[model samples]
Target: MVFLKILMERSRLPVKNFKEQIMSTIHDNPVVIIQGATGCGKTTQIPQYILDEFIQAGRASECNIVVTQVSLLKCVLILCARSP
Candidate 1:
């Protein structure tokens, strides 16, 4: 219950951010480039993208989406058991 409560109370994350002063502007482009070595929020953000699309397309109630986090077993354990 505690884990669920924390996850529910946590803020919904925003979309990925592009580099500032970048030659390429994502403002006009739907596809934004977010570069990071690893362990970034890419996996977490993709679902938000899908959810937004579903809502924008008026299929939010119909969309049954499942997102998997392919991280280390230990990381998965911690996320599901403790935080979310």
Candidate 2:
């Protein structure tokens, strides 16, 4: 819960529009493109947001999130950095 709060604080995704726009479009459509600058929490918060929403709706078992990391080194670094 605390960790989510931290991620929410750092996230740049607009909360109001995130639910109305992004999440809804993701559910209603087959494909969606999110364009944003770096440090916008796209790499971290977005997936968490999806998972949280699904869990809250009691559909987490029906959802799957696949993250394809381009760089092994960067991926490892990110995982390490995010670890408490």
Q: Which candidate is the best by lDDT?
A: 2
State the lDDT of candidate 1 residue by residue for 3-84, as single tens digits: 7875553333332442233324533676544544454445555555556667998999986545444456568788789874
| Global local distance difference test of model 1 | 0.53
Worst 10 residues of 1 by lDDT: 14-23
Q: Give lDDT: candidate 2, residue 29.
A: 88
Residues 4-81 of candidate 2 have per-residue lDDT tens digits of: 987567654554346557777878988665655555556666677789899999999988886544576588889999
Candidate 1 colliding pairs, count:
0
Alpha carbon lDDT of each predicted model: 0.53, 0.70
- How do all models score by TM-score? 0.36, 0.58
> Considering every candidate listed, which one attains the maximal TM-score?
2
For model 2, the superposed segments whose C-alpha errors exceed 4 Å read 1-8, 11-19, 69-84
- In angstroms, how far off is 36's CA in candidate 2? 0.6
